[model samples]
Target: MIFTIARKEFRSLFAAPSTWWMLALMQFLFAWFFFVRIDDYLQVQAQLTQLANAPGSTIAVASPLYSALALMLMLLIPLFTMRLIAEERRNRTWVLLLTAPVSVTHIVLGKFLGLMLLLVLIVAGSAIMLVTLLLGTHADLGLMLANILGVLLLSASYAALGLYFSALSKQPVIAAIGALGMSFGLWLLELSASDNRSFLRAISPNAHFQNLNMGLVNSADLIYFMLFTATLLWLTIRQLNDERRSS
Candidate 1:
């Protein structure tokens, strides 16, 4: 039953012209950045070779591109997450979902999963550009895998937060603004604070993503992401239940 709901939600996303337009815009931005980074890397190849006479010099050369890609992802995720639930509510489709035989948990999970799946495809598509770089240069497979995992986990956290906010509002524009404001605010806090605020840093998804990007998979970081995602999902479920009861 959950899968059925998820399939419907996933299909709805594809059917929506706005979703495709956003996806097209994202792809264009990704491609443009990729080309610019590759071109910059090529220009600096000579300088890097002069500085380091190492076997993995090409991998070192590609580090800047990876960093740029990560930054772009951080900016892009919230936009995709904005409409997941808010649009349904704004269109009055959420009432239909509430009256369905499926449990609130199932509905929330199904939607979350569907968004995650779409995010996975977006991530995978961006990765193809990275893979193309590997053809002529030696890249670290393990490092690349770690980067991908970090991206997925980071995206999951954003999606969960977006879902929660979507449940809180019936206006899709309000939901998008709220989600972006919260995400950007959290990111800014993580960036602006000193190391003395390590406790606060641990709570930010961007902080954990930094560790993952460095190829350091700490269990604590994984747990933080899991807990963050789970808490928001639970909040969304509660919100749905409360709405149904009130209705």
Candidate 2:
């Protein structure tokens, strides 16, 4: 049942022409960034090589590319997730879903999984672009794997946050705006903190994302992402359950 709902959401997203346009824009943006990174690396190759502990092409290129995509995901995910529940409510389909045989957890998790499939595609595209470096230079596979894990967790967090906001309103625009505001604010919080020990920074997913981005797999960061995503998903489930009971 969850898989059925997931497929339905996935198809619905792709059925919209805007999704295609958004993907095309993403490809263009990624291509441009990929080339820019390669160019910069080439320009400073001499200086980089002379340094005993200089970063390789993988760190110079792939790391920053992943970081850029991570930033882009912060914006893209809200738009993608805005319609998950808000659209259904706006179209008067929310009651039908609420009355369905499946539990609220199935509906919410299905939608979350559907959105994640799309995000996984985006991550794959970025990975392919990053892997192109292997044709000309040695790349750090470990760092690349860590980056992939980081971005997946980060994108999932964005999706979970947006999903919760989507459950709060019938207006997709409001949902999108609320999700984006919260996401961008948390991101800025990470940037605002001067020390790693600050509680404000601790609340932001981006702070933990940075540790993974550096290829440092700390158990605390893993726990943070898991707990963060689980909390949002649980909240989304509770919201739907309340709606079901009230209806």
The best candidate by lDDT is 2
Clashing pairs in 2: none
Candidate 1 per-residue C-alpha lDDT over 136-201 given as tens digits, one digit per residue, 9 for 90 to 100: 887777777777888888888888988888889888778878887888877877787699357677
**Model 1 clashes, total count:** 0
lDDT of 2 at 26: 86
C-alpha lDDT values of all predictions: 0.78, 0.93
lDDT of 2 at 42: 98
- In candidate 2, position 67 carries an lDDT of 89
TM-score of each: 0.91, 0.98
Please write out the lDDT profile of model 2 over residues 1-247, one tens digit for every residue: 8999999999999999999999899889989999999999999999988999999998888888888899999999999999899988999898888887999999999999999999999999889888888899899999999999999999999999999999998999999999999999999999999999999999999999998888999899899999999999999999989988988
Residue 166 in candidate 2 has what lDDT?
98
